[model samples]
Target: MHEVFTSAMLAASVAAAPAQLSSIDELAGTWTLVAADLIKTDGSVVRDYGNAPKGLLVIDSGGRYSLQIFKAERVHFASADKGAGTDAEFRSAVLGSSTHCGQMRLDGGQLHFHIEGASFPNWEGTVQKRNFEFTGEQLRYLVPARSDGTVPVSVWRRLAGQAARP
Candidate 1:
């Protein structure tokens, strides 16, 4: 179940929460996507990547962000050109990837992802809300539901210095 932050809860949290988290700067850094699991209603977890998923969530000082998450065993396009991949290859690539670019906002630890565009066209121009948690160098968020009615909980780790493009 999701935690709802009431006024009293917000007040209590603000007292102990660091000031940086009150602003976007708290999220301004390179964060490696550690997990994205589809939580089935049955309580079983379905993961996109068989092993550790490959992903990157980068936030600039301006609060603008870009994210790319992919499965580990993706096959390279035999055609070598992005647009020229075979039909099966295209299906595998598309189904195994999630990408988006936009801006981020936080309200009492809740994160709002303002999508300018996304690989999944349905999400383009949409604003999705998620509950966020910060623990040490980790940031976690829960996306209510994906198209399949499965919840996706994303975990990210704060990376020191510039990380390779994901």
Candidate 2:
């Protein structure tokens, strides 16, 4: 009876071990732009937004993603410079363009994000995704460049349990 109990306990522990491991489900949700620091190849940090740049990242269980980034200062410029142009026009010209697309899973932990009509031509290529880590309420993922040349790395954080609109 003692041996049987010990075996059952061991089996239960083993079964629960996989659950402890992190999975992509942890990343499924909407993420607000907490902070984005673009690191240049020369190790220079460019703080374009000065603390808060409006941005959002949405990850779905069906393997889809959409991202938007904007600058608060641009709204003022757009209104002044665009000549009655809508806020969208000002945002596009100033903060750059937003990216939308579906992601394909390369493996259990890696994903290939194909940007749909990315504003930046260089980013239009396939993005290799990896290195996912979660701390507290934040989930981060790394996007490496497909080419050997310099590429920007993106770090994303969860958006307080809000569902991704797109």
Candidate 3:
């Protein structure tokens, strides 16, 4: 019963999405993160990654991909050695960045991630779906709503001269 309902919901979402790229090859290339925001139920926006978030996304023609996002102002560890960081520094580091990678599938306007690994261990070995749209060189996607009802949205811009795979 649960599976049936889930399938129905998935079908509905796909049907409701706007026109999508004709082929996944259209999404192949490198993208730079432009904005990361959390929209509250009351319609206020919060910058989850500060004013200047840094991120890179690379997707290959074979459907393999890697992604990393960082807070521009994340505090550097006081110690030179990465293995030697204070608890505070470690916590700050972990909380300020997001990284994950794996195979991807684009179905309609949905971007599905078969997460093989992530900075947040809970996401490893999980499959997540996001709704996305493209505008010129930019792509925007909405993350599933969090338990607190805030939705995270990410925007990315394709780099110059990155050709799409046929």
Candidate 4:
């Protein structure tokens, strides 16, 4: 009877304990892109950045971060001059990459990016909130739904030996 009571008490105490909290400091490091996908409302997945995307994300302990993602299969501009690209080439170039830098903070299990500037000029000076989770070395985040109702999701793996310096 005593053993039974002790076991019951232990289970009750464990049930009353809160889940372990996650800290923003755990995100401070250099991460490489694993995948960039878009999820449709009907449950179909689209690889918007091609089958193998390329990207980098760097987060500092000081709350600053820079993120860049690019399509690995972008078409090369035929012209040697950077400013001499055709309209289609320019559009392809713009559509193939995204980059932004800003201050980031975690609140209520969400990450808020206060954009100082971005390749997409409309995002400059705006705050974007993302729902994110960490699994082992990978960090995954869901982008808010767009007007078309597709949600973008990005997965990044923390680079080994790239911990943030004090």
- lDDT per model vs. reference: 0.72, 0.51, 0.77, 0.75
Q: Over the full model, what C-alpha lDDT does candidate 2 score relative to the true structure?
A: 0.51
Report the number of clashing residue pairs per model.
0, 2, 0, 0
Candidate 3 residues 55-156, lDDT tens each?
A: 999888766889998988888999899999999889879988999999988874678889998999999999899887665477677778899988777778
Question: How many backbone clashes can be found in candidate 2?
Answer: 2
Best by TM-score: 3
Best by lDDT: 3
Question: In what order do the candidates fall by lDDT, top score first?
Answer: 3, 4, 1, 2
Steric clash pairs (candidate 2): 31-159, 32-159
The TM-score values for the models, in the order shown, are 0.79, 0.57, 0.85, 0.83
* Model 1 C-alpha lDDT per residue in residues 70-94, reported as the tens digit of each score: 9877878888689888988988888
Looking at model 3, the pairs that clash are none
Worst 10 residues of 4 by lDDT: 1-10
Per-residue lDDT tens digits for candidate 2, residues 7-116, read: 23322332332322244455578777654444345545444344456778777766677777665445344346457878677555655534555563445544457665
Q: Give all candidate RMSDs, comma-separated.
A: 7.4, 13.1, 8.2, 11.3
Q: How big is the positional error of residue 139 in model 3, measured in Å on the Cα after superposition?
A: 0.9
